[model samples]
Target: MPKLHALELVPDEAGQELVRRDWQALRDAGLPSQLDHRSPTNAPHVTVVSAPELPEAAVDVARTRLGSLLPVRARASGVLLLGGDRVTIARALDLDDDVVRRALAVRVQVPDRQHVGWLPHVTLARRVDRSSVQLALDVLGHRDEVLTLTELRRWDPDLGAVTWLAGH
Candidate 1:
């Protein structure tokens, strides 16, 4: 089977620390009860593009395109409701030239859809209900924060593994 792949904007160590602290505060306040079942090490991150499957050469292409691209500042803008099960914290990315060009080159075809726009967002919690999400928003108070895009990741579905291909 073809693997699922995504181009994501990962946080740096310092950024991750900030996110961890925020998560802890939320957890302590009982805003993220759903997180209790998951590991705390699963920090926050934003995805640029996701594809159901990629060509075998996609990784190589991604690596080449990403290697020289410098890291950029991504500022969180607001909170968004992704689905009933998930809530997204959105960020505005200062994408590098190569990053933008490379992302535009990749095409994703979702069934029954003509095209889906690429929306950049970092997830706060999964399997969350509306009440829980409302609690989280109330706790977070403000919808904005600044984070850095530090890495790109590749995920293999068949192997059920994720690999970090680039880091700044």
Candidate 2:
């Protein structure tokens, strides 16, 4: 079976901690119960690239491309409504050339033109009702947080998990 895999920017320790606290706060503040199977171990990450499946060589290619790159600064600033029912507040991160090049190197048949356009973002929540989304937005309005991209991870299909491949 082909695995669904993605190359994502994993958050550093401080960022992960902040995300955990924020998620807990969001849940505690009566945001609608949206099921998130991900954990602090998984935390939150911005996808650099994704593919249905790639050859083992692609992993090497990704590693090689990512090995020498330095970390970039990213920030979360606005709320995005994906479709009517799905909503998320996201942080926008600056995309470096190396990140884009590495993402493009991975072959993925993404139909979303936006995805192909090198827009990098990390989602804070999904499956959120309008009221909950609005509440989140109100809570997080104009808040700025700095996050560091610490590692590159691949979503392994066989294991149905994300694994650390390389760090820069």
Candidate 3:
């Protein structure tokens, strides 16, 4: 799979700590977690749009349109296991319809962020081992949280960098 650029919704300080605590818990349990990603740019975020290539124009448009809808109330629904063999454990999010609508308006061809069937989530662990799935689940139960997504940022994995688009 090719690397992708993404527009992500960043949580406030308190919300971030909530996620970090989860990461730490998984780490303490000797399970795969976002903490293992090892990049300074690696942080908790709900991806709104992603594509193999995102142009500067597209980024600017997202900054203007999506940025205007700052401070969205996002509910961390629960823990979800995505993918087949190497599962991705994530915290599902329940966002407003308008947020989903504007995300599709970005016109990105990424299926994961499509309006028809988009499962918004903030990933906790990537490619967790099958043997650790049950353990990870046990470690991180169905914990729910109400988080305020306060910032919009663009993630360029190629550069290992993030460009803050909006919010305090």
TM-score of 1: 0.71
Deviating ranges (above 4 Å) for candidate 2? 1-3, 32-35, 38-41, 107-114
**Total clashing pairs in model 3:** 0
| Per-residue lDDT over 1-168 for candidate 3, one digit per residue giving the tens place of the 0 to 100 score | 778888888999999999999999999998888999888888899887777778676777778778999989899988888878899999998889998877666655454442345578889998898888989988988878988899999888899889899995
Off by over 4 Å in 1: 1-4, 33-41, 85-101, 107-115
Q: List, residue by residue over 1-168, the lDDT tens digit for candidate 2.
A: 344566677778887766666666667776632225444345678776666655666667666776446465566554455647566556666665666777676534343223445667776666777767767866556566777777877776666777778773
Candidate 1 — number of clashing residue pairs?
A: 0
Instruction: Pick out the ten consecutive residues of candidate 1 with the lowest summed lDDT.
Output: 106-115
Q: Candidate 1, residues 57-135: lDDT per residue as tens digits?
A: 5556666665446365666666656665555433244444666666554433223211376555566555556667667
Q: What CA root-mean-square deviation does each model show from the true structure?
A: 4.1, 3.5, 2.4
CA lDDT for candidate 3:
0.84
Superposed by TM-score, candidate 2 places the C-alpha of residue 162 at a distance from the truth, in angstroms, of: 3.3
The alpha-carbon lDDT assigned to residue 131 of candidate 3 equals 83
- The RMSD (Cα, Å) of candidate 3 is 2.4
Error of 1 at 123 (Å): 0.7
Clash numbers, per candidate: 0, 1, 0
TM-score order of candidates, top first: 3, 2, 1
